[model samples]
Target chain A: MKRSICISALISTLVLIGLGTAAAEVVMIAHPSVPVDIVEAGMIRQIYMGQTTPWNDELAIAPVVIKAGPVRNEFLKTYIKKSSAQFSTFWKKAVFSGTGTPPAEQNTESKLIAYVAATPGAIGFIDHDTAAEGVKVLSIE
Target chain B: MTSAHKSTFMAVLAALLLGLAPQIGAQDIAIHGAMSQSFMQTSDNNYLVESEDGSFSIFEMVLNTTANIDAKTRIGAQIYGREFGHLGNNHMLVDWAFGDYRWRNWMGFRAGRIKFSLGLYNTTRDIDMVRNSILMPQSVYTEDFRNVSNAFHGFEIYGSVPVDRLGSFEYHASLGSAEVDEAYFLHDVFIKVLAAGGQIPPSLGFEANLDWAYSGSLYWNTPWEGLKIGGSFVTSDLYAEESFATPTATLDMSLDMDLKKLYVLSAEYMRDRWTFAAEFQRLFVDIVVPDVPVFVPDVGVVLMDIPADDRRGGYYGQATYRASDLLELGIYLSVFHPDWSQRKVGTAETEQKDTALTARFDLTDSWLMKVEYHIIDGTGDLPERLNPDPSQLVKSWSMIAVKSTFYF
Candidate 1:
């Protein structure tokens, strides 16, 4: 009986750790020229919504996003407070109405890093461990 | 341009955008499209199309591309083709094309053919996959006069102002001209109303010129998440003229109408997997006809003026739930008062009530299908020609609409 209980505990721990990894800590990364080291939570939403755009008078803003997946789900739920469907619908309206267009999407974390690192006006989020050189990390306040 | 020319133009433009965006642009350009087909059937009455016996006349295809040129400036356009019964008759047109420049969170400018916002969903009417209902509440969104109310050729200014800890306020205002070149029902309504006022002609046609319109809306996003309240208003002048073949005599007949006032109150609350929305709107119009000679059957020509005022209003409450990963459900109750000033005067002629249920199924990541059922009471706004006689029209009717869309 004791051996069974120990086995159950070990399995539960492993499952919890796996779930945590699926929703790992996300870091807001941007091009080096983006004029911010840290961004407010509300401002991030606005930026993605195309409301708070422009790093300066001369530079335009670009918001990069991830394709549908566990990491994408966790990031949208934590920051945007919207489901993937709702986000897509909102941008669909914008696109069809000629009001706005959705941000570009990168299918993988490495691609997201590479795009943001190379683009001058890109802003995106990725797993903390995946943050690499050439991109600025904006800590959410 | 002619509809054929427009169709070819849009098709070629779409091909170019899809084919050349990669090589021409230095930044990012995204293209998206949706194809939708629908079937609608009504039990006792004909709706948008000849729905009495089931119709497959509803179809739409749209292609759009947006290019983020730099940051503050972006340009986008959509090529839309639709076949709705006898309305569009399979024609492609430019739905909206505009260049947008945002100066800040509180200010942005758009110039071109901009889709004017109405209540909440008007601007997005052409987007099929965004809503679960195959047809929105007809009382609030009459599909017959779609082209006249779809967009305006002008510019608009919109922005959001956020208040610290209190939420935000968004506003949109536009000034533009609107024309009704081929609105079947609107034309029929005028002819019927004129006939009721005692004018008989062999054949008649109507030309409506909406001189200039000003529309504005303000929405308050409360501190509470997923809650918003807003109001919208539109004002315009419509000058209409009549042309007819008298056959026996020359007739001078003309009329003018003004959209004196139009307003709406809207509210919506959305939470996880659930959304509740409601809106109420009213339109006040005044019509004036100068004393004109009318061709009478046997009594010869006579002259009279038919001046009138009309009030129309409607309200609807809706709720939608994302039932699961593959399905969504929605229901709404819509009430319309055709003659708001005499709302309770005539049971069937003055008011209408519609109860609708909708189910949406997601077959795949790119495909969705929706089935909707509606139970309707009263004929408040049904066109007189659809039924042989408006006075003898049935008070109860039902309809079912099924649609599928592939979007990308």
Candidate 2:
């Protein structure tokens, strides 16, 4: 009976560890200068779509994006109701027609942060945990 | 003419200049091109004789570059060339050449071949994909006429102002010259009667005429969200000089004809995926033909009478439904009434009406396709040639067209 109990305990412990690792893997990050109020899924979508054209209420909005990847896909699917492929196609049409410009892209989260920091009108998204200096975390609801 | 050869030579020269120019500043030049092919089926019942055909191609290329002349001023130029199959053709031309002095976003001055900022349709009219409908409004911008007779060579002053956090207002005023030559003719035979009338004096031989036209528009966004109002006025003092000779006449005399002035007012309301727009326009023409006599060498002299001035006005309303981000459906109706008192010969003293339904599908990011069908009816006393039977004074026609545009 003791031996069986020990095996059951070990299995439970392993399962707990797995769940902990999964939770820890989530990344959080934001631009250092941005206030917490502006980080929302709708605002992010607006910025990317070129509908929100000002950084502040008084300035024009400039939205930045990262190249398509696993994380980027997850974020867009959850927030923008579109896939990266769809976004690319949409912007391609808009840009060529001179209606609007597409969001600028960087290769990685760090690069996105750097871009948003240097450009005042710029907004960008990164992992939740990477919450680093100079980037603000927009809420994605 | 030598103009064609000269343009070819100029193209070669431009290529050579591009190759030899030094790459020094941050300025860059890029070349872009697009090609599209479409098929159409039409019925003569609408306005003109309609037919069915396939595989027409439209190709265009643009060379664009921008440079900073100084800290406060920047200059840019774009050279464009376009070719249309059998239906129409557009030659190579300078699309834009302008110098910008940007004190700030609120104000600026641009001098060159500036864009006509008259209406929402006018600004992005040249970009095929920017429009939701494949066919633009025939009354505002006719495909055949705009292809050759559109645009101007001149300067413009434009600026924008933000009004207390509600929305911004933008205005542009331009003065320029447009040199255009357009010729159109129709021939029809009625079962019972036959009548025909063309431009009194044929339009030929007279060139180098000067044109003065002006356009201004003001746009305001209301604090009440989702509503925008704008109005534009365009007036042109354009004339063409032509000379015609009768079968027995010797001396070629000059006849001066004037194109009409036009004004347009537009208002739009947008809420999410739904947009409603309406526009009203007035066209005024003072076409005067002087009294002249024709002498036949073998016969005798005949007195030719001239017609009076012509005036026309119309209004159109459109509703667009965005089914999705990539698909749109639109329905529009237009009514036109021409003053027949000004018509010298043929009988067209009535109101003409046109109604159309259109569907647009964005097949891919770079490819767009559109299909439209139009129903046209003519009212009042129709010309004998236009009406085959005396019992009927009205005629109707239907037309169907499909266009596909691809961009690269």
Candidate 3:
């Protein structure tokens, strides 16, 4: 009985570790010229929702997103509190209502990172493990 | 393909693509569209169309283009072709075109054919793929009045205000006028129900006109992530001119109306993969029509005029669940009271209740199919002109609707 219990415990630990690794850690990123280092969790929703005016009243906030991936889904579920389907539906409504446009899309995380680094007013999210040398990592409140 | 469908489809595609397609790769421009063809069948009389024999006369095609010009300015427009039975008649028109400028998070301005925020779903009614159900709730978004209730040519001011931890407030105020065609649904009620029933004189000519329309709404988004409660109010002026010839001379009479006291209370909650929503609406109309002498055939006597004005409105509650990545299911309980004053309650026509069930399947990334069934009780929202036979206008009926859409 003791041997069996120990084996089961080991298996549980391995499974837990695997799940921990499966959930990617995503970070909010922005262009270095954005002039902001930290983003309040509340404001990120508005920025992504296209509700707020341009940041600093000059630099328009351009949101870039990855096409379809776990990182994008995780970020949406965690930050925006919406599923992929809900997010797309929200954008579709905004577009048809003539109120707002959807975010620019990139096919890969690397491409999204590059777009954010190159655009002065761009903001995006990517996996924490990716190299973000030219952009500013925005810490969430 | 029918020329009507083919020409409309090609025209919308051509117009939208010519304007926004070449820049499809641009980061600041966004282009999206959807086209849906629906087949509807009813057990007895027609509903929204001649659905008695499984009619396929319903079509909604739309293309929208939006471009952001810096952070403070953006402009967007939509072109739509909607055919609802014998109306709309395959006309391609700009649904809405507006230039928006936001100076702050708490203030913004919009002009040029702005859409009225009638309720949770009016502005997005023509965009079919955004919702799980094939048709929105008829209580607040009756398709018969969409032409007049859709949008106006004017400007609006809107804003969002955050109140610390209590959540936020979103408000809108708009003023404009609408185009009233002779084919507006109100005329049908005048010519068919009132005149045919001998309440009004047979008219030689009829004219309908609308005046300035105004609307406002305030929403309080609770501290909860996906819960919101709000209300909207809209009012406007309308007039009708009737011309008739007696033995002596031709007389022209007018009726003054105010589409006033239109109110809608709304609530929506989104939790995980489930969505719950409800809305209640009331339309209070005040009319002033002079008593004119007219010969009546039904009563066989000359009598004074009596306007057919009664309070109208409805309420609906819906729940939708995303069962999986590929499928979703939804249910709706919708109720509408065409005559709120109990004037027509004896004929089993006081209210209409619709219990609808829908299932949606995502066939591909850009294609989807939906099937819906409705068990309706009452004839409150039925069009009288379409079903002339009183015996066939059954109190209890059912309908089936199936549609497919493609979007990007």
Candidate 4:
């Protein structure tokens, strides 16, 4: 019985480790030309939802997104308060209705960083460990 | 266009789209498209067409592009094709083209052929993947009037205001006019419905000309996590020129139809995997037919004056649940009153109630399939083309629809 218990414990530990590796830390980033270095959670949600179109009365809000993955899921839950499918449907409605368009999507961390840094008023997220330059890190409150 | 021509055109366009797919690789320019084909069947009467026999006649496709012409300006347009039974007839047309300018978060302007902001779902009524049902509620979104209600050629001012404690407030105000074809108004709506027990002679028709129109909406995002409330209003004036021939007389007439008011109150609450929504809509239409002289067999000249006033309204409550990542379920109860304060049109008041159940399956990230069933208790909202004789309309009926959509 003791041997069986030890084996069970080991399997549980392995499963937990796998899950831990799956989770990712997401960091919001923006172009250096953007006026703000921090954004409220609500503000992030609004900008992504196409509800808020401009920032600081000068900078037009342009949001970028990942096509899919855990980082996208984390960003959606934390800032947009939606699931990936829900976010997709929301943007689909907006786009088809002539109200708004979905944000640009990047397939790789490097491309995401490059787009956010190069385009003024652009915002996006990447894995926290991804090395990024020429972009401002936004603190989400 | 003929079905053969439309088919060839669609094939060519689809080939062109395949060629253009690889070029949409930039942030400043985007291309999107969606296509859906649906099959529908109704019991007893034809709704939209002779659907009682079950038809695969509904098709829709849209290709749209948006280009950011700077930081503050964007220009976009959509080319749409649809075959809604006898309505669209596989015609391809410009759905909307607009230039948008944003000054700030609180102010923006859009000018061109702009979609009218109606109820919560009016703007996206034709988009299949966005909604859970095959057909949107028909009372408020009368399929026959889409030509007048869908979009207009003009401008709009829109903006959203952020509140401290409350969530936010958004508003859209627009002024425009629409050009409607005689077939849209005369052949589809008036001729079918107003001819009583018989069909209108082929020689009788009317041309609908809109003078002006205005519409607006106000929306509030409440403090509650996922709750929203809003209201909308629309009004327009239409001038119609009519020509008719009877067995013994020919008549020419000019009429005025004033869409006095159309307003809707909407609310929605969403949490977790569940969404609840409700909306109430009311509409008023006044028609004035000036006295026209017509020759009669017995009387040399007779003056015919026909006037009509319509009071219509509807309400619907719906609930939807995301059963899983790949599946969704929805149920709704919709009620309509064609003329609430009337006493004499038929044996009973014209009221329609529909209870609908729907299921949607996400086949893939870019594809979806949906099926819906409706149990209807009245025919007040039934189109005349489907039921040539109102007296033959059954009080109880059922309908089933299935659709598949692909998008990118």
Candidate 5:
């Protein structure tokens, strides 16, 4: 019984470590030209959902995203309060109804970071460890 | 335009968009389409169309493309084709094409044929996959005047206002005119005339002259997440001409009607995978006829005037629960009355109640199948021509529908 308890404790520790690593993989980013250094979660949601069209400086805001996955799912759940499927359905409704358009989607983290850095008024999310030189990391308030 | 010309036009449009696709950034262009075919079975009383017997006649297809010209400017259009028993008749048409410009978060403008933005579901009613049920609640968004109310050719100004900690407010206002066909417009108008002791020959021909329409809506997003309330109003004018051959003479009749006003109040709450929504609507209609010579078969030509007025309204409440990643369940209760004031003649004041249950299964990311069953009471809104005499309709009936949709 004692050996079993010890093994269980060891397993729980390793599982928590794995979860911690996964949780640390994502962060919000914006083009270097963006003037804001920090953003509220609600503002982020509004921007990504196309509810907030222009930034404070009168420039149109462009939001980019990735295909569905664990990281993308986590980003949506934390910021937009929706699942990937629900998000897609929301945009589908908007597109078909001529109400609005969805954000652009990039294939890879490097490409997404590069696109955000190069495009004016662009914002996106990337892996925390990715090399992002010309982009600004937005601190969530 | 002829079918050949329409096809060529669509082809050329597609080619132009494709050829310019590379010049436009790949990420700025989006092309999507949806197709749905349904089989409907009704016990009796063809509701929206000819479905006396089991019918597999409902089909809808749409192809849409949107391109961002720049951060603040974008252009988009949708080509739609549908055959709903007798409504669309399998004709391909341009649904809407528009260019949008946003100066700031507080203001934007769109010019072209724009979709009519009304209640919560009016805008998205045509997209089957986004809706939980095969058929939307007809109580508020009646299928009878679908074409006339679908969209308008004009311009609109819309914007959103943030309310500090209380959330945001969205508003849309527009003025435009809608294209109408005489046959369908006459079908809807003659229902009341027939009820008013008028007879129309079987081979009736008509022409509709279009007029102006004005519409607007305002919505409030509450501080509490997933809660929203909104209201919308619309008004338009209708005019048409009908001519028929009699034994001794031909009668040309003129019709001028006023869709005096329409309003709807809506509320919705969504949490997790569950959604609850409700809407109440009111519609006022009137017919205006000036001095016109009428030729009756037995009587000589006489100047006659006949005008009618009625108030119609309805309400519905629905809830949906996503049971799993691949399945969803929904239920709705709707009730409608032809005349809210109950001033119209014989049985025209009858009310209809419908309770429906629906289920949708996502077969894949882009494919889905849905089934629904409805228990309906009364025959209030069915076109008079379809049922002829209201007394002949049974008091109760049921309908079942199954549809599959694919989107990309």
Candidate 6:
């Protein structure tokens, strides 16, 4: 009976950690001026890679990224299908070749929101619950 | 005039310009420098005797400036220096000097010294942060050949055409006169005179190049993905001629030449962390010697030297894996071969095959380091001058270079 009680206690602790991680929400965001239908994962990949210059359907896709950090890694894996390091190297090569440039990086969540709000075609991400006015939430597949 | 005196005159002129120029529109100036030291141990000392001991320094400095000339145009300049072992005292005349007139998105022209947009790599050769590999692919840009020319003075017309769904097509066409300084001519005097009169000769060789690239994602289900394929080709005319008169006889000679028709084929695939690329290049040079007599002193006989034609081709394949934001690993192999049958005396030809392996790591956003080792196997039948001593064949060399770049 004591062993069963100890096992239950460990399981509850693990569940709490999982719940805390899930509670930290990430939201795809764009400038209010941009009329994007839904910022999907594939679209974000295209804009960041410079494959798509201007968005169609009355919108322009501008992407902003956070500098490499724990939050950046979690967001990229969940939305971009790649890690932060891979994206960096890919963009470095592109920039060196004069073929493309990576999306601008913001140092903090507030900075990201400010940049996206001011830039007409800019897009970025932040904690879903913290998203303020002048930014639209994009859908992630 | 002595080189020192010429350099002094240039320095004085630069000082005068900076002192007297109007300050109303003066732009900011910036200075940058890099110092690197590396050591290596090799089995043989034949390739670079000084390098065999394995310690060297490669240092460089760049003076850059920008002036806001007007709303539509901006002026910029860069002066660079390098010191690499005994091959010290290297300089760059100008990275680029051009005026852009953007009348509209569909039409634009730039005139002055400009970078050759022949391939994806040529335009950004100077920016360290943007390149995919530590060193440029040799097949297209022969950085090893000390005098390999990368930029030309000329005019270019470029524009983009928008498409409905497939994305737009961007195009560039340029025409420019090739420039070769006195130093470059002196280096090639023994074999050929590639320039005349401190500038390109009056014949003023011309170059024309074209590039077509498409940008857009490839999948219908995922329309926002990005993929691009670009290719470029350039051709130029090179000419040199001279005549001599002697008491015993009169010798007249002329060479109407079309050489170094360079073509590059490149494709890049980038999705998330993996990037793959391949490049193939072909270069051809035609040499025509008109009735040049070769005299045999012992037999009192004269024989006309026959002209020859030579061709060279090279290819490279590269792959890179990004472990994280701070570290990247890359491996590439390249092969270069020349048609030995077409070689002539006093010419630039590779009698043997050359293969190289290179690895690069990015320690940080501002620092990059790379190491490359080369194996050169000389063909026994190389031209006499190229291999003055046949024993100098089959050599190997290893070089490690590190660069730290910063931008503000």
RMSD of each: 6.6, 12.1, 7.5, 7.2, 7.0, 10.4
Task: Give the distance in Å from residue B72's predicted Cα in candidate 5 to where it truly belongs.
Answer: 0.3
Q: What would the TM-score be for candidate 1 when compared with the true structure?
A: 0.87
Candidate 3 at B55: error in angstroms? 1.2
Write candidate 1's Cα lDDT for B1-408 as tens digits.
633564467556645654554575525677789999999998987777778989999999988887776667777778787888866666667777777888778999998767777788889987888887988876777776566567776889999999998899999999997555456545554567556745545445445666688899999989888899999888888776666565566544566768887787999988877889999988888877767556678998687666666688889999997755577789999998878887778688788898999998888878999999999998887875566466657889999999999999
Query: Which residues of candidate 1, in runs, are more than 4 Å off?
Result: A1-24, A128-134, B1-26, B194-206, B241-254, B289-299
Predicted candidate 2 versus true structure: per-residue lDDT over B348-390, tens digit per residue = 3455556888877778756788888877665431333333444
Candidate 4 C-alpha lDDT tens digits along A34-102: 888888888888889987756665566779998878898788877777767678889998787666867
Q: Rank the candidates by DockQ, best first.
A: 3, 1, 4, 5, 6, 2
lDDT per residue for candidate 6 within B146-256, as digits (tens), equals: 223355557777655545465555666776654333222212221332122122222222212222211111112122333455666666554444443434454344544
- TM-score of the second chain in each model? 0.89, 0.74, 0.85, 0.87, 0.89, 0.67
Interface RMSD of each: 5.7, 12.5, 5.8, 5.7, 6.5, 9.2
Q: Each candidate's TM vs. the true structure? A: 0.87, 0.66, 0.86, 0.85, 0.85, 0.64
lDDT of 2 by residue, A26-120 (tens): 23344454444446555565557644433444334456777846667666655555545446645654343222446678998788888888865
Candidate 3 stretches with Cα past 4 Å from truth are: A1-22, B1-27, B182-184, B192-194, B197-208, B240-255, B287-293, B296-305, B343-347
lDDT of 4: 0.77
Worst 10-residue lDDT window for candidate 6 chain B reads: B212-221
lDDT of 4 by residue, B213-276 (tens): 8999999988887798999998999877666675666656576789999898999887766788
Whose DockQ is higher: candidate 4's or candidate 5's? 4
Higher-scoring candidate on lDDT, 1 or 2: 1
Structure candidate 6, residue pairs in collision? A85-B324, A85-B325, A95-B130, A96-B130, A96-B131, B217-B225
Q: Cα lDDT for residue B188, model 4? A: 42
Clashes of each: 1, 29, 0, 0, 0, 6
**Poorest stretch of ten by lDDT in candidate 1 chain B:** B197-206
* lDDT of candidate 5 over A1-141, digit per residue (tens): 999999898656643532331443678899977878899988899888887766654456888997755677778878887766678878888899766788888878888888898987888987677778788999989
**What's model 5's lDDT at B45?**
85
Q: Candidate 3 lDDT, tens digit per residue, A2-120? A: 99999898656643532332456889999998978899877888888877777787678888888877897788888888877788888878888988777888999889989999998
Model 3 residue-pair collision total:
0
